[model samples]
Target: MSAYLQAKVVRSRGLCVLSSIGKSVLNRDLWLVTVGDATVPYYPDPESPSTAYPKPKFAYIGGMHGDEIGNVQLLLQFLEEVCTAPREARLQALVDSTVLYIVPCMNPDGYVQLTRLNANYKDLNRNAYSSAFPYARPTTRDATIRNGYGTPLHPEAAWFLTAGGAAMEPETVAVTSWLAAVRPTVSADLHGGALVASYALDACDSKGSINDCPSVEAPLPNLLANAYSMNHKGMRVQLDDTYGDGDFVNGTTEGASWYTALGTLQDWAHHVQHLHMITLEVHSDKQPFGRQLAVLYSLNRDSLLRLAEMAHLGLKARVVDAVSRAPLLAHVELLEPKGMWPPEVEADGLIWKVAVPNMRYSGTLTPVDPGNPDARYPPISFNFTLAASWDEVVSGTGLQGLSAVYTMRARQARRK
Candidate 1:
């Protein structure tokens, strides 16, 4: 770890000390870095009328295959910015509530070689699904369309597969294991040389839902993906394809299939540990550095902000519960409300006031099950009992707390 991530060699941006996981086959120490609060209380209050919210966790893994360089730079840049930036309201809020873990380089030996496969020539992503103890690395690239070349014997693969899955490569095992312990809410493995934000959920497969794993929940997989797309849709500075909006597929193949590579990082984090894992392909092989950097910043800015906002809002219910006499960790979804106001009166300085809707339109509430890792909270139907109106909060024993607020422009006000 020291040899590869020497402090002197790395530019001082978001420079956190790297912990030694172990050594590579080529005799290099594997390393990892953890950022944000580790210990925090997380529980739902049943008596409360809303959901209990805790800080969200985000993990960014880069340089896994070695040749994917853009993501490594992006992680470095993010680390620097996060470290130097003052603990303003947003930053502190995210830190206090959310955990951000970044693995800048996964396969250091392979990274030095600048090859898609690690030093052992094994494609790390392919052989990650074995369940047996001290998993074996696949010696063959016959799995997916020969995406890349390499055997499991590659020192990097052997370290993780033969050693204990991710543990085979000391750095990868340490980081992956730590993630399992922390159970981050979201994580993404950064990849390059691809243009789409490929989501490998089990879609159109005869092998019985291969994409449905313990890590990614049903609605959330789509919800988070859509949110990312929506955030980047209109940004003027963003490039055409940098935001990762594209069709969804189970894997990089035409058919869906079940996989069980015991030591795979993404699958381990999601299935074994239950974190929302997304593989983000950051740049194409032909993309230039400057343009790639622009794309990275755009993604970091919007995606991180959205994650923070959702985490913050999720915390709101718990905060409300603390103040109220009754527990408020009930099923509640806050929707932005919209309403039409009567003609506004301009008096003293001719400033106009538009009436805004205090309550949000009612939507279904899903009851969360704490014990079930793969289970999605069932949506509570509310439309049958009440008309969809802008004024009422629309609460029930079934729906608990569903509220929203909407702000309309003054120019759109109607006449009495």
Candidate 2:
């Protein structure tokens, strides 16, 4: 099989602007294809006018596992369609406000051999961390894996043993570094072989999942839950009929058969960078490649458009101060632990009244020390509060103090 993509992958002519984000382990050009205009700010800037380009961003990753060919095709199709579609449409309007960053394939070396492991036989997903540099040398069993190419010593094990956690492959290092820089509000990593949306949170082996993390105070996750349902309308039908898990569902019940790998892209994406994330498994039963690819493309089209729209709509807010009885710059965070979606934070540019969506969130406004605005230590107290949405419209005060405890609504959604 040729290392290059043999499929007829043709994206829309004007939709995607492809650029190299970094180089892979073997020095192949790693592309960071963006599907929106570049004039927008990456994060929300309140100082700018209402016409200010909104900084809401959503990231989509595909083919972190090189062998997941379906994801590669799906993402490519999405890039073309979303970029070329009319901006006045709901999907294009969302894309206009939201910035999308996609890494179509993370493991170029592994894809070359049609193998799960990368060039040095490193499993890209398993090997993710700031440390763990210098690709790990495969052990004796690695040679055995290479030999048993045609036959499966159990397909699950074949895929499982391909990589491990904590070791950072070059691609992962580049991707993670970029994630830190972009700090997107919402992100998703595309995977295959399972036809469901998996919101795997911090706990490895998918145990002790929080229905919602209190830190995400807003109704952000709830909005996403509804959005996910809306995007996949009429297709969530399964024998069990249980489509969404609300938040985290323990691994034991949901066929938790895989090994627990730490420092995963999703974990770091949420834990470290504070972005809401989902591991979208597209299709099941290891169906026909062409059929699976089509399913992936179908799912990607709706999901991507929905996410971009949500980011654009969700980022709308105003900041104010508590003591001055005036508009102030404060930090607002929206977190969802169950879905592993990162927190969304906005500072300043709030006016007398702000209309927040029904979604739950831990909202706060902090007094910025003119001396050191970024000072994270010993944060100042005194923020604003409005009991109800109507109250928020009239109140002009900043936050009175720091939150007694950071609260979010991810767990709340799971409970209901």
Candidate 3:
């Protein structure tokens, strides 16, 4: 796989760049393949206009479960397509408009062993810290999960308060850290064992049976799920009428309604980072074999690309301190908690939110500085009317007419 990735770099003519997010439990390299123009800085300088290549970013992660081998292959093919596609193609526009981050193998140890858990025998999905569950963020980190089930005893906790939480695995740390750095506005976590796109707002019965929960944040998980399912001919239909959780509404299910999962990547990405991530169960009963790879690619190619484009369909804003003009990590939201999609500005001071087109949405941006309270900024409110089509306009910032990026200056002083 490493050689294939390197070959792509050579064949891509600077289109594909490879780097390591971190190591696996057994010290295997967690390879991160970035497919886009490498010359542009991820976050362009606000003061300098020419270098401001601000656009939405889309991320795809596969191979969370070791036995789900096809997940990794699917993303590999997607990367290859991106590298080989014509410069004038829609894929090129995706690359030009947004920075793409792909991590084909989030669990190399599991893939090598062909097991669902990592070398340490842990589910990487369950290893992440979730905002949905109110477990304390551990002060002193360790690799031991307090609850072997990877769930909370209380079952319903708000955000973590105390400095005591479960220990985490290395794979979880690596993926979470990488996700924080990338800060994808829209992403998809590929999986196997089923054939439907799953959104969030979850719950599992006592018998561990999954249900059909709807999104509190409507059109978020739903829109992306529909985007993927409607594009994939195979995803929208069910060969077996009675599947695990029965037929999803057009091949889409709410995360909670599917089952009660603890510390899920889907919940963590949305609740904590405001990233619109969906769990795509790519295959039917089990993982498909070599012969089915091409079919899987064919079914998912357009669906996945649609997700990349969806990243740019909503509001995009970059907020900074009004005084120093330096970037500030502020919390930006477009709706209430149910329809809510609030993304905190990355180090780049940018938030590209995914949303339904042609709607009027308003939200508030509150700057945070837990480390230094004096540096905190007041909340700033915004109102916007989205275009009927792919209307993501960048208002203000002396950059009207061009609806790609917006700069918001928060009136506050940086603590000396």
Best by TM-score: 3
Judging by lDDT, tell me the better candidate of 1 and 3. 3
Candidate 1 local lDDT, 45-106, one digit each (tens): 35432342343456677777778777777776666555544645655555554556677777
Worst 10 residues of 3 by lDDT: 391-400
Give residue 89's lDDT in candidate 2 (0 to 100): 61
Q: Which lDDT value does model 2 have at 380?
A: 31
Per-candidate Cα lDDT values, in order, are 0.43, 0.47, 0.68
Which runs in model 1 stand beyond 4 Å of their true positions?
Answer: 1-18, 21-23, 27-30, 39-54, 87-89, 132-172, 200-216, 233-264, 286-291, 308-416
User: Tens digit of lDDT per residue, candidate 2, span 72-122?
Assistant: 677766665665545436555455556778777777676666666677777
Poorest lDDT segment (10 consecutive residues) of candidate 1: 346-355
* Candidate 3: segments with Cα more than 4 A from true spot: 38-53, 85-88, 129-166, 203-216, 239-246, 318-343, 346-351, 363-381, 389-416
Q: Report how far residue 163 has shifted in candidate 1, in Å.
A: 16
Error of 1 at 44 (Å): 12
**Which is the better candidate, 1 or 3, if ranked by TM-score?**
3
